[model samples]
Target: MTTYVINLDLPGAVQSRHLYGHFAEHLGRCIYGGFWVGEDSDIPNERGIRSDVVEALRALNIPNLRWPGGCFADEYHWKDGIGPREQRPRMVNTHWGNVEENNHFGTHEFMDLVELLGTDAYVNGNVGSGTVREMSEWVEYLTRDGDSPMVRLRKENGREQPWKVPYWGIGNEAWGCGGNMTAQAYADLARQYATFLRDHGDNKLYRIAAGANVDDFGWTEALMKSVGCVGCNSSGVASPYQAISLHYYTMSAEWENKGKATVFTDDEYYATMANAWHINTLLKRHTTIMDHYDPCKTIGLVLDEWGTWWQVEEGTNPGFLYQQNTMRDALVASVHFDIFGKYADRLFMANIAQTVNVLQAMILTDPDTGALVLTPTYHVFEMNTAHHDAHVLDVVAKDAPVSRKIGDKKLPALSASASTKDNSALISLSNLDLDHARTITLDLRGREVTGVTARILTAPDVRDHNTPDAPDAVAPREWTEISRVDGGLQVELPAHSYVTVSLDLA
Candidate 1:
């Protein structure tokens, strides 16, 4: 094997907190039967959430989770979701399946879920079909300590204390199901709604304005300049927008009557990986403009919603967005995470499209069998968790091939990043070439290497996936023989794989 070695001695570390983790929406199996099954299901649960699912997420060391949204946040009325379960109103989830939301999983339920997982809560407000009063009251209900109308209502509804929800989105996809507003129109509404949603003091709420769909720099530029001109204290001193939201999904086949899923040729796979890798470019473009306007890093690039977009399973409910999670998906996820790790400075947060039963879900469920399966992508998150909260170590790869196409192009076969956290050195590598496995020799140089261990996420076949029948098909495996040679390390990474090498300093 002709091995390649990455030298981490020269480059400084890259930030990892913004690899910020994922989300769960009120769509398809994600809500009703995916994450929440009420307090009475036979499956092992902690206050109604499946124990296995919770354990899977915890393993990922997930830092933050955005709740009750996508386009759903716009139509959601927080008040309708609280109070007595039976008395709480049932509303049709207009964005997902047009199914009745049983009010079973409401504010307290979601907050309880996040707390159980030991992750932060990023709540999205209802701006499309909800009022300023509704938005403000929800914030007060969650963050307020004093006995206000909303606080008293929360106590009456069974929760007496407050949950420190730090991140709040003004709207979700305002140009689409969020509100169907023009770029300028959404910015105006976001400013209006953000004015009333007050922070209750424990934590400064990171109020995020709804951003564009794809590469709409116009939306970002207009919103930032417009908000800046209005002055920082225009709508209360706490009203400054901390992050601007953006959403993107990588779909291999883009025509989209229903993009092909699961069954794909090599070209399709390559195209998908290429497109997924474009996140680096998108982040650069968006961040460049934000830097020009507010260069001090005051405003963050919140990739609030993102993940793989594929066709729904044929026999299943179309709106459920059920699809297979193959090793290819895992490879795509690996590259995306590396990109996020590189841009950790500018990118403050990101949430995968969902946690379960939605686009690129980390977990999948079969309610009838009560089966819970972790996808390959889930394994990637779990492996990369060590990078979280660890200050980023900057590094670069030389002689890596950059894939350029007629319309869209991307970088070469190798992606690498290093970080030193908790007194240990962690190095992550992504070998992007779909056909050939790579033998890399990492030169740690002066850094002493002891107790070297690696977690490799790869499958015998690129098409290998996790199914309800075989949940652990593509799970991670440990490789300790990846050598320490004369102040250097030799590792063999399979084709299109993600590898993480952990070393304890001698």
Candidate 2:
């Protein structure tokens, strides 16, 4: 039996809603067929943006969206994506598939999508292949008001009023595709570029410097030393960039053989879970370095890119990064969110890589039939949406069962996190054991619970997933096997399950 003692009186930092944010890059079908079907296409759409995808994502209460590239951002020239769609230049997407990119879904299209979804924008600018003036003008073009050169260009391109861009990324992976620069070299360039990313009108940009790849603590240290804090301002905030980013993807196997998304053995599953658990360590180590420099914790850490990276579906474009999402993916997401909730103070925002029809996508779209299927990972996001911006509740698990063993390490069978908001609290738990169900006791403290409702996301097999023909193969269903206990509540968590319990506290 696993017992979780949640202290209701002791609430921690408000989990930033942005932590549930998503990423949309110009990769594979994520952009073209997934989100955009063109205004004239047969698919039901609003001004060229697919309405189904919009409606589906809106259900997640998506807070923000990062756009226009992973490696493509560094190479993408903003000018080519503006003006008339017909006249917009056609360029080869050198990084992704070497496919020709007809500049149809550019700045205007993206902002329109943002408007439709009612989400904030996190735009990554070009720093590797683009000039300072180009990056500055792109920011000015989207956000600047009144009559400036960039503003006039924006108006000429059919948008008279300026758009609100709250978050802006300096570059993507500076240590890799964004430019093979050393940490110090990238840090110097970040400072210079950040200087020109001005706050025009009432819009103040939250500039995010492209941070480390995975465990490159030296890169994080360099950015902190060079650009994190130059001097304190009147308000005591002293970072050139408001936040720094980190990108880490969970691969069940090695880079060359990133195990199949839907097919894997128990050993592979345990290995993947172990890899997912490693992010907690990475966060702790990075936070230690960050705490040393800005003891005040003014600057934020944006885990802008993260998710499972499996091999491309066979016969699909390898560069497209298309893969199926399954019960395993949902557990991975649950684990990540649990960790994200723990580090809410320093980790302000996180965007899962490629929201639709790409790596660990929420929704998969069929190119031939125009069919859309929500992935298992999508349900986890919907179930845990209550934690967005809610106060974190301290949950201590005692005598948690060991799920399995990976090498010498004994992996825990359960993962849990709690948060409170308004007059209610949410408890999310994941049972990683593959064979047996575990009974859990919720030892609620400091508050009187009036009512409880629960939902569980699980499938008979961990490999179960949704296809266009069967969209609900692995979806959430009402979980009613919960009973009132002396102190709190008791739940029967089935194997390979993700459960969320909502409590009405008085």
TM-score of each model, paired residue for residue: 0.94, 0.98
Note the clash tally of each candidate.
14, 0
State residue 18's C-alpha deviation in candidate 1, in Å: 4.4
Clashing pairs in 2: none
Give candidate 1 misplaced runs (Cα > 4 Å). 1-18, 229-239, 255-258, 400-407
List, residue by residue over 10-118, the lDDT tens digit for candidate 1: 4344564646568888888887788888788888898898888888788877888888888888888888888778898888876676788777898999999999989
Q: What C-alpha lDDT values do all the predictions have?
A: 0.79, 0.92
Q: Please report, as a residue range, the 10-residue window in candidate 1 with the lowest summed lDDT.
A: 230-239
Candidate 1 lDDT: 0.79
Q: Which portions of model 2 miss their true places by more than 4 Å?
A: 228-237, 400-403, 408-410
lDDT of 1 at 118: 93
In angstroms, what RMSD does candidate 1 have relative to the true structure?
A: 2.6
Q: Write the per-residue lDDT of candidate 2 for residues 32-139, one digit (tens) a residue.
A: 998999999999999999999999999999999999988999999999999889999999998999999998999999999999999999899999999889999998
